[model samples]
Target: MKPLNPGEPRQVGRYRIIAEIGEGGMGRVVLGLAPDGRLVALKQLHAQFAHDPRFRERFRREVATSRLVSGAYTAAVMDADAEAETPWLASVFVTGPSLKEAVDAAGPLPVESVRLLASALAAALTEIHRAGLIHRDLKPSNIILTSDGPRVIDFGIARVAEDAQDLTGTGAIIGSPAFMSPEQAGTGQVTGASDVFALGAILVMAATGRGPFTGPTAPQTLYNVVHGTADLSDVPEEIRRLAEPCLAKDPARRPTPEQILNHLGPVPPGVAPWPPAVHARIRQQDAEVRSVLALPLPVWRPPPKKMAPRTKKILFGSLAAVVLLLVSGIVALGLSIAEYAKPEDPGVASLAVTEAVSPERLRLTDPCKVLAGRFVKESGTLKPESGSLHPARCKYTGLNGVTFNLQLGESVTVSGLERTDRTAEGLPLLRSTISGGCDSVVQLPAERRFGIVVSRSGKEGDPCKSADDMLTAALARLRTHEVDRAGDPASILPLDPCAVADPAVVGKNIANAESAPRTLRICEWQGGGNTLTVELNLGAYVADGSPVDLGNGVTGDLRGAGTTKCTVHWQHRPLPNREAEHVTVMMLGREGSGSSCDPAKEIAASIVPKLPKP
Candidate 1:
């Protein structure tokens, strides 16, 4: 989850948005707090879709049908507003990572966990099909894995079985490429059976990291969906027996959700459905929700009423007399207290030197910038490297490479560290020795801590002194160069990528183009058999690929993935901890469209100038 951006609304109907949860081609989902203290996952349609009357009518109908769906493994819809300017729907928020994230982090699930997942999803499909609706998009990303069980979510594309037309009426694909059933890829005649086929593909992904019919590209994958056989060689035998029948090309040959459930039987009692690592993620999300709820609510005040001339005069006269009396009382009180006031103890005064790091300041601190290479050059000719998977840590490389890590607003425990009677920027400094390296940490208020570690290749220099010097320099730079989102609202951190491109320009490249946010910082526009993607990212700026001058003092690295796709990457600015803010623009064209890079360059040239200057 990420904090809401600058232009994002704080409230949607009665639900107060806490943070963004996820985004997709259709809409974005956010964590919301309802009036009764219940947390919900609220999904709001993109403005482009809300403006279309046909899309709004379809969404209203789908929402009404989704409200009728209820089961042990499905997130129930709590509320909806299809008539609003930006239509939204709220559903019970389930705490867990999506199945895709779980698989990516922990590899494939074990046999027992896969069994439990298969059973729960089948039951969820049963409930959904019983509601007279077919879930058009049922991929791994739509399933949330909880400790108790798997809960299916994101019914944004579900519709009645009889409605066979696509949303755009131009035959654009609506579901994931690898997971779409053969019928959906070809004839577009979807039914309950299509979801079963998707379930089979998901089961294959859960047992193995790849889908059953996945190919080199999306078009190839779609073709495989229509013609190829299921690759069950990597799948465990136990799951293979159940998944084989579901993957039959003929829908009539596939088993119903009820049959699949009966075959798997009931989930075992008292046993956790997810693996230990997945359960740990679920617990983390649960704690995050609690912390968000504990924050103080924003105060709401009504607009002041205007008064007539006579009433204003009377009020001013009465306020003046009250101020005069209050001023006289304060003066008398100060005189009485001055005689009794005493100086504070020196020890007590010294203890108060440390400044508390406010939550607002911590949120805007870019971890990558805290220990930048320029600040650490005295120790060695260091260069910034790619950051770790954890967003709070950054790595540097040179004769003496170092890493800077931060743990903010969380309980921090330090062990094997010798306390020193020293301070860095008024905060207590601690030192520790490690294998071939030394570590130094600066302790802050509210359990926050920042550490710098220096590693020496040989026993030539004092690692502790290097660590300390780097930490001190970082602290000094942080005090002055901290990222200020309020002062620079135009920073990519707050701007929506979908709004960066001009609609007219986008249409000139691809007729009938429609935009959707693929993630918090990434957006995609698709039409006319072409796709353009814009992404705002933070990483090391590698000077690989061909350099193209994107006017306005900006240059980008252009690389081609294949004949049909090309991408351009450019660094926007240097961020904390050595990483740089960057932008990526990718273009994917139809099979015979020669040199996708031309169109990609054109689009990049148009949008790069619109971005905020470094």
Candidate 2:
């Protein structure tokens, strides 16, 4: 490969001139912006490689295989026209040093980070295998360590193992020698297991800052990788265990992706469910956003203020970072809260665990909060038509057995009640009102939405003499629920509507709340029939108006325990009778005296009653 003349346009089909990102005996990879404005690393085939019909066929197969493999951990194939003049291909431009560069500049990654990297890459290879393709070339140069996470790049040599007989024609060495699996070198075919073998080699490099199989020449490295054993003596126990399975001499002995995820450990309870891929993407985006934000604003700005090209790049990068941060923050905040919950105090709050009965048999004297942070009282359980009260069915299996699920809309419901129940201190286990389809219910713990089956058969004890004891039990339940629902990353961030009010109005309320500390402004808006939006100015509790760390901002939502005179109407309409009765109770404690507070209920006089009988 030779360098092109300066300012001379080099075209590969529709792709225009761009600087080269990498060059080798096979070809050169040019950096180009796609027609749609996506940065793509375009690999342009050198004349020598392109002229070989065998290589062209292999390259075409690589493009097809790459397109079939779609994963968050892998660099996505954006565009490729293999049949074109120069047979160009493009992938998402990952901006960061390669793994080789990182290791060379900063030394080997920490042990924990290395393990994380191995697990992530192992998981990515699992996807590649699932797609019926093998990344024959898994080398350090092809591994991109971007702000988001490690992305497996360069699928140029990737091929389906099943087609190896037809594609390879005769057994031939095709991939990097040091990372090649024994099967790849011998049979010219790489299976899902082959990637596992390569992953072990990569882990060895990440751990000791050197490849396990090394040689001054490619042939020597190939010889060692084909017959030699990896040195795990230097690898830490924690990571060595992970690498050992991948390094299994017999591919059948290696762990599958599902098995690998299981070995990652039990998922924390009460957090939003996320599969490994989404979970990884979330962390990657979060880190990338934080990194961009940490850069000085002026430093991130374009050199020429109004230059169209530079200005566009700056705007694109900045916008991308901000969006990533906002979304990640919302998700992380929700998951973190569920993951980290302090135990309830012993003196103030107590916990009680009980069996669940049929829909009409269960009972509740106190109000309860469900999945969406919504609250319901005991009276809400009765049906208007029959005037007959229904209970959320709770079953008994030996001892502790109950499953609780609560969804909100017209009324609350429990679905698919299982033999499971968990406890939480200060978490009100109120009554549930059945409405619409999906009739199922179970009680939930604080900072958690899932239920668990307690060990009721054990030594009989409430474990609720004090709030502290109840809290300890509740934390256990939270952790349990998190593991059960491990998938669906969207659940990580529950939707939260912002409180709309003038800053000046909020400022005035803050001043009053600080000085008088007793006066609170409660405003309500009718969200049409069966809905309302209540605004309670907690002043400082709304701190910077951020939804997270909402201190003392518990209004009529769950925390108020049906005591606050604030409620937000969800839908925009008037109630059928232009009225729905509700009450608000406020208590003012002496200075630093929340415990000394007294009850004061403010009931709405003569509001609309329940829906007219059918």
In every candidate, how many clashes are there? 4, 47
What TM-score, over all chains together, does every model reach?
A: 0.50, 0.43
Candidate 1: C-alpha RMSD after superposition: 20.2
Clashing pairs in 1: 368-576, 368-577, 369-576, 369-577
Q: How many backbone clashes does candidate 1 have?
A: 4
lDDT of 1 by residue, 544-573 (tens): 789998889999999994568899888888
Query: Per-residue lDDT tens digits of candidate 2, residues 334-450?
Result: 753222333222121111332111111111110111121211121111111211111111212211221122121112223433322422433333321222212222244221233
* lDDT, model 1, position 199: 95
Error of 1 at 601 (Å): 38
lDDT against the true structure, per candidate, is 0.73, 0.47
Worst ten in a row by lDDT for model 2: 605-614
